[model samples]
Target chain A: MLYLQVLINGILLGGLYSCIAVGFSLVWGVLNIINIMHGSLIILGAYAAYFAFTLLGINPFVFVPIAGVALFVLGYALQAGVINRVMGAPVLITLTLTFGLNLILENAMIFAFKADYRKVIIDPPLGLIEIGSAFVPRDRLYAMLLALLLVGGLYAVLRTTRIGRAIVAVRMDREAAALMGVNVPRIYAITFGLGALMAGSAGSLMSVIFPISPLTSVAFLGKAFVICVLGGLGSIPGVMVGGIALGVLESFGSLWLGPDYSTTIAFVLLLALLMFRPTGIMGKRGFE
Target chain B: MTGGRLLMAVAAAAMVGALPFMADNYILRIATSMLMYATLAMSWNFIGGFAGYPSFATAAFFGLGAYAGAVLQTKGVPMIAAWIVAGMIVTVFAAAVGRAILHLRGHYFAIASLVIADVLREVINGMTNLTGGGMGLNLPVLKIDVTTQAQFFYCAMLAVALLALATSVILDRSRVGFGLRCIEQNEDAALRLGIHTSRYKTIAFSLSSVYPALAGAVYASWVSYIDPAEAFDVLFSIKPIIMALLGGAGTIVGPVVGAFIFQVMEELVWRNFLNVHLGLLGLIVVLLILFLPKGLLGIGLLSPRGRPLTAKAP
Candidate 1:
């Protein structure tokens, strides 16, 4: 029963992780820029949620879309103005540019908010639910369900919408897409905006369960990379499986090998996976 | 290549060789540190700038050398012997590791190198009995005149820098150098051209590790103390790449110029803008990447203008 409970907790946490990583995977798959600033942007969303909770008595569940929209605008302008200029440079240049953006964002947050850990805590909405000798927190249950809904919505938008088809076409061949009358730059902006939205939503959801601090970005960045790599770029189902696997592995690792070492397990898994299975599980577009 | 160039090269070498008499202890210390780092950047350039595989394992090799030097020094081994032994150890390790891992492309290779650093750190931390674990190890400072000792290290480092530059120049002109360039341009075509791609890559990777190992050994001798965190710093691994990129990669003079620029800016930042130094530096790097994609040398700039000398028949 206790083991089952741990497994349930892992799956819930995995859902949150999947949400955090999908935006990153989407950006990498479409833009071909491994935006190192992603974790910093997620931190921005968490802070936005925290402030919303503090000032207006708004809960995280309500604040997520607000934060998501705000971040979408920020991400859109950033990509359109700064990042798009060097879109054709080597991968190293792209990596370095995002790294610089990360530094700016992190320091700006530090200057504004001070380096204090903040959390959005809500008084328990309702009592815990028990099913077959396993217990689940009401907040975690909601976060997990929300993750599923958001991913499904995103998947639908990409598959069914005209804009979605343009994005897919652009991903398939940017030059050909432009030749075919698709506005390539606009599609790029939309993808950046959408990726940021997912990160913002994940950040808002995550603030409730984890402490929000500037430095937490590094761990989340590592986690997102591990999750994305495991699932493979351009593979949505791969992310779901990857996220759950990482969460469970981390939970069991913490339980068995001591807590300090649990964090390193993701990085270790990432290295091993890249070495052994560079294509990633179910990856449609192989690694560059 | 004629009289003037030959004379300039000889004059520069002579000045560095005679620096022990003119430079003060403080200046010599800085020079020593600069040479060590320059060596590291050049080594990193062999794989990263030239081979087009950005590695993050220089720190691992450096830390490995430091620990090896520290252990050997504690056992009463001479300084020169410790440096050579440490370099050889890291060279062998790099060859073995690179054979298996360098096949991973792009950021996968970069991140794998990072993981290697972390794992090396973990292994060192776990082996408390050999490494003194987290606390680190100390070496007895050799009895010598303070001024001359500093100057000696400075000259020694200059020699290493010269050697590194020579190696790069040779590799740039050699068949292996041609092979590396072809591989960098396109691995599939290089394979079709019968360039034994993995063999060349592994050789480049192994050669790259040697300079960091030697420099780390020299650093241990200079500082007389070391720790796992300081030895295997991720920032240390990053600095050389930044220097290489800033100076203009894949060129002999680039890393050298980059090291000089980085050290000067770093010193200024430390002195003037203490809190936001990294932030500012980050901005500079981003701006460079966006605007000056070929870095300071402006290699990419030539393509747009299509000037007679710079233009290629692409």
Candidate 2:
């Protein structure tokens, strides 16, 4: 029964984890920038949702798209205005640039929000549902479903839409895509914006389950790294698999090793994956 | 080295050596910090600047050194011996880890290195008996007066910085240094040229690790307290990279010059904009990378074709 419960919990958590990594994976895959500001962007989304819920009396789930759109604009502006200037520089330069952006965003949040943890508390607590000796919280279940839906929508957009094909085209070969009349810089901006949108929505969903603070951005970023490495970089389905795997593993790890060791386990797993299979479970060779 | 350059070096060393005698405690402390950062920046130059590895493991090596020194001091080891032993321990550890991860290039290598400090922090936290977990640990306080102690640490840090500078000078002239530069330019070509890329990279990585370890040890002893959080602060890994980049990476004097300039800027920004210092630092980094990729030293030192004189044409 306990094992069943843990498995369920892990799967649910994995859904959220997938949501977190999906945006990061896309930007990294397409832009070839690690987007160190990703976690902070997610936090910004969470704050947007938190403020909306508190000030506007709106549910966080309802405010998810609003947060996503807001972040999309910010991400698009950042990539277009700032990051695109260094698009031709070394990987380290871009990474450092994003790191700087993260510092600015995180510190701004800290200055504005005073570093306090904020959460959107529902007026009536959403209770839990039991299935064959395991109980799952309603909020987590909704969060998971919403995450899956968003990921599915994104996957569909990539598969069917013109812009999606352009992103894919750009990712496969930038010069070729540019030669084919695709606006490479614009695609990069759109990809970054999409990534931020996903992060913002994930942040909105995460606020329901976890406390939102600027400090947790690093942890979120770390998890995204682990998941991306685990499932493979730049692959949507791979992120899903990786997220669930990490979720399940963390669930079991925390159960056995105590909660404090969960982070250590994740990092150890990341190092091992990086060493043994830098390509990740589903990643092809060149992505590494 | 030219006689003029050697003489300038000596004069600079003498000036730094005389700082403790001439400056107040606050200025002496800042000088000590500048030296520590100089050591860190120079150390980072070996792997990051010369070898082009973009390692973020500075905090890992530093925290390991601090804890190793602190734990040994608690066990009644003499302070200097502890610092030396800690350096050796971190050097060996870095060499091993470098061998394991150096094959990864670009972002993969960066992420792998970044995670090291986090893992070390967790490990240190778990070892409650030795590291006191998250509660922090205290080193034995020196019996000397405050001023003397500050001077002692200042001189100690200056020695480490000088050692790093000397090593950088030697590396710039050595075959191994040439090999590292080749590897940085193109690893595949360097490897094909029979330059033992792995060995050179590992050597660079270990070289980068040692001075930061020594600096960490000296820092642990100076502060008289060490915590896993403070020891493994990611800023320790980041600030040195910024310093190196702010001067001019891959040059002998770049990291040291950058460290001094960055320290002064940091002190100024921290004083005036305490609340937004981090944001300001970030702004500086963004602006620096965007507008001055060649660094402050590259200003007016361009070649006829406008490339930085020190940089090889890509």
Q: lDDT at A111 for candidate 2?
A: 97
TM-score of candidate 2's A chain against the true A chain: 0.98
lDDT of 2 by residue, A34-115 (tens): 9999999899999989998888988999989999999999999999999998886777788889999888998999999988
lDDT of 1 by residue, A151-202 (tens): 7678888888999888888888888989999998888888899899988888
The positional error of residue A265 in candidate 1, measured at the CA in angstroms, is: 2.4
Retained true contacts (fraction), each candidate: 0.53, 0.70
Off by over 4 Å in 1: A124-127, A286-288, B2-15, B144-149, B299-314
RMSD of each: 3.5, 2.3
Reference-based lDDT, residue A275, model 2: 96
CA lDDT of every candidate: 0.81, 0.90
Q: Write the per-residue lDDT of candidate 2 for residues B92-153, one digit (tens) a residue.
A: 99999998999999899999999999999999998999889999998899999999999999
The per-model DockQ list reads 0.47, 0.63
